[model samples]
Target: MSLSEVTARMAKAADQAGRSMDDLSLIAVSKVQPNERVASVLDEGHRIFGENKVQEAAAKWPMFRETYENIELHLIGPLQTNKARQAMHLAQAIHTVDRLKLATTIARLAQELGSCPDLFVQVNTGEEPQKSGILPTEADEFIAEVRELDLPLVGLMCIPPVDEEPSLHFALLAKIAARNGLQGLSMGMSGDFERAIALGATHIRVGSAIFGERDYG
Candidate 1:
């Protein structure tokens, strides 16, 4: 689909949810996309883009940085400890902070690097043991722990189970954010974003729907 179509769909979803289009931010998940494709989307007035892997983002961002200084880069995948320094420099927000070690790494790096981006705590809403997130039962304690850090704990992020409806998952994340005074909900992707918006998703990460399926061969 074209960028215009994606924007229209986003606006329509916001309208359906009784939210102004201005209130929501569309984060184009440009994980495996080329820099040219990112530039094309930037031409469409999309300033926020999400990348899922540190290596891919590291390889791609330099090509656009000089030209797209105002664009916001977000890291939306599990981050490794070694990548924290580079991620802090490039990312405007990190959406997959699930462990204290990684958080401490980011905080220490942010202090040394002289920059700290917005931070969102990722919760394992589906309680999938394989996923990279804090467990639901431990979320409150985690939030309290992170509050003392210098990073801005802006909200929570979660990926629902792939096969099930996401409303419950989205609602749970929203509730957690509310209980903790966080203001953003970074839930939902292309397949279930409309439901997520209805359930109070302030930020939606969309990739396939906007850029088409990724060719991973």
Candidate 2:
């Protein structure tokens, strides 16, 4: 689908949910995509994007931001503590502040550098051991911990287990957000974002549906 089609669907879904498309944000996942393909999307005047790796984003986006106006970059992957500085440098939002240590690092770096991006706490709503987010049960305390660190905790994020129902996980994340008084949710993707929209997703990440698939090596 093209950006206009996706935006139209988002508009319809938001209307069905008693919300406006202006209340939603779209992030094009540009991980593993070539620079030319990213440029094509940029050429269409769509700016916000998500990248999974600090290294890859650091390698690519500086030049793009220099050339383009108002580009917003989000770090949407498991962030290593060592790369916290790089992520802070490149992204306008960090969507995987999943642990106390990482939160502490971000808080410290933000204090030192005088710039902090909006932070999202990732919840492992599916309780998948292989995943990087905090367990759902740990969310309240972790969010509190993040607050103690003085990081700008803006919302909750999750990637539900691929085989399970995504709506359940999205609802769980929303519930947790509501309980914590957060208003942002980065829970949907290219495949199930329409459902996510119905459930009040503030941000949805799309890649293949808009840019086509990349067989990442």
Judging by TM-score against the true structure, name the best candidate: 2
lDDT of 1 by residue, 116-204 (tens): 89999999999998898999889999998888777778999999988777898998999999999998999989888788888888899
The top-ranked prediction according to lDDT is 2
In the order shown, what is each candidate's alpha-carbon RMSD? 1.3, 0.8
Off by more than 4 A, model 2: none
| Candidate 1, residue 158: how far the Cα is off, in Å | 0.5
Q: Which stretches of candidate 1 lie over 4 Å from their true place?
A: none
Among all windows of ten consecutive residues in candidate 1, which has the lowest summed lDDT?
Answer: 1-10
> Each prediction's TM-score against the native?
0.95, 0.98
Model 2 — TM-score against the truth?
A: 0.98
